[model samples]
Target chain A: MPRKTTIIGILGILLYIVGCYDGLLVAPADRFMGDIQRIMYVHVPCAWNTLVCFTISLVAALGWLLSGARARAEGRAWKWDELLEATTEIGVVLGAFLVVQGMLWAKPTWGVYWTWDPRLTTVAVMELMFVAVLALRGFVDEPVRRATWSAVVTLVAYVNVPLVYFSVKWWASLHQVQSSPSTVDPAMVLPLRINAFAVLFMSIGLMGLRTQLARRQRQALLGESDSDSTASSGGAA
Target chain B: MTGVMQGHFDTVLWVYGLTTAGLLGYFATLLLRLRASKAPTSGQTRVSAQNPEKTS
Candidate 1:
């Protein structure tokens, strides 16, 4: 990992701690939900970060597809493949976090551990789709083939992300509509925004480290293939 | 339901506890994978030395 990303990660963690303190102690309890409303601080941030990570994955997937096509046409590098792999993995982790946090919030607010609410169901589907993309990577042996297929699948799966976001608006569900600075209390907004930015920075930092790891893994695989081919040729000679 | 206090302190604690644990666990796993990737294992060193062009 890069020194800059590590610094950003540390800063993000510090901000998150401050935001948690403010959310838990400083912000007044909600009139309806009381102290349980504090769950919004972490839950909302996880939800937003999950979407952001998936968005990054979508953009990287598109980059990979386009660059891959261009590489075939003009014989160039496919650096975006590394990015696609990294972002998808990071997105999966964030998506998993989102589900767990949402579940925790739902149990108290909705009186059940889970329900088939449209928003919840849509988010679950989106998470599973991206997870399938990760699984796809492991099964493919050829580098180019794996990258191409994963990118295409990701593009198809990305259709669910927007649906996850708009599900509350599009359908009547137990989940609340998207909260904004206007809808939420001004005092609550500060900690929520702070945690949002904290998670955002942390996601970027994790993605950077993951992308580097993916690059290294790819290089190692290529080196192994190179040695294998050379050995075969030497044996023939 | 409006303007009624629902003191669910247990819920708040559970949410915070679970979220913190999940985030920390994920971060630890990522760090471990990164460390393993960076460590100069014998196989990786041999591969890197063999394929000079791939390193850069």
Candidate 2:
């Protein structure tokens, strides 16, 4: 691992410990939900990072599609493609957890493990869409075609991201509106803010590692193609 | 802090415990995949040719 990533990984661990301290012990409990409300510390941060990862995937998808033809042909454009893969995979993982966390939080407050509410439904659909993107990428045999198809799928799937965010407001639902500094108690916001950055740093470090793996796999695949073509050319000569 | 509130702290524990497990589990999976990709195999030579893996 790079020194910078190592530093970030260390920083993330430290911040997570501090954030847990504040969130679990220091912050006052909500009068309504009481201590169970503390779940928001982890639940909310997972939600935030889920959206962030998908947004990053959308940008990476755009990068892969918009790069010049020469860049694509020379295999230089695989960076964006691999990044798209990494972020999409990470987003799907985070989104799955977000749903479970929301369910856990909801059971105590809403009195049900789940409902067909707008927010929860949209998030479920969004997670499944990104999961399909990962599955399709694995199914394709050709690298360029796999990258292109998944990128296009990512673009289409991103349409649901905004829907997921707006679902709570667009219609009556059990889920609360977005949390903010103004809305939450001053003491509560401190831990929320800390954990948000903690999750962000950890996600970044993970993305870095995941992207490297994607690149390495692509390189191996492409190298096989190169070797095959080279042998054919030599035989012809 | 209230007696009733203390009764439901389990909800908080559920999310905290699950989220920690999820994050750590994903990180472990990622590291294992990366390690698998680095296995000594025919593809290792090809991957090294594109851009050298960080030696430092």
Interface RMSD of each: 4.0, 4.1
Question: TM-score for model 2?
Answer: 0.87
Model 2 interface DockQ: 0.38
Top-TM-score structure, candidate number = 2
Clashing pairs in 1: none
After superposition, the stretches of candidate 2 with alpha carbons farther than 4 Å from their true spots are A224-237, B1-6, B39-56
Off-target runs (Cα >4 Å) in candidate 1 are: A68-78, A224-237, B1-5, B38-56
Question: Best-fitting candidate, measured by DockQ?
Answer: 1
Candidate 2 chain B worst ten-residue window by lDDT: B38-47
Q: Across all candidates, what is each one's fraction of true contacts kept?
A: 0.66, 0.53
- TM score of chain A per candidate: 0.89, 0.92
Cα lDDT tens digits, model 1, A1-237, are 478887888888898899889989999888787898898898888888888777877787777566534353332334566777877877788788778878877777778979999998998899899999999999986667787788889999999988988999999999999876778999899999999988877877777788777755665565533223221112211
> Candidate 1 DockQ category?
acceptable
> Cα lDDT of model 1 overall?
0.76
lDDT at position A24, candidate 2: 88
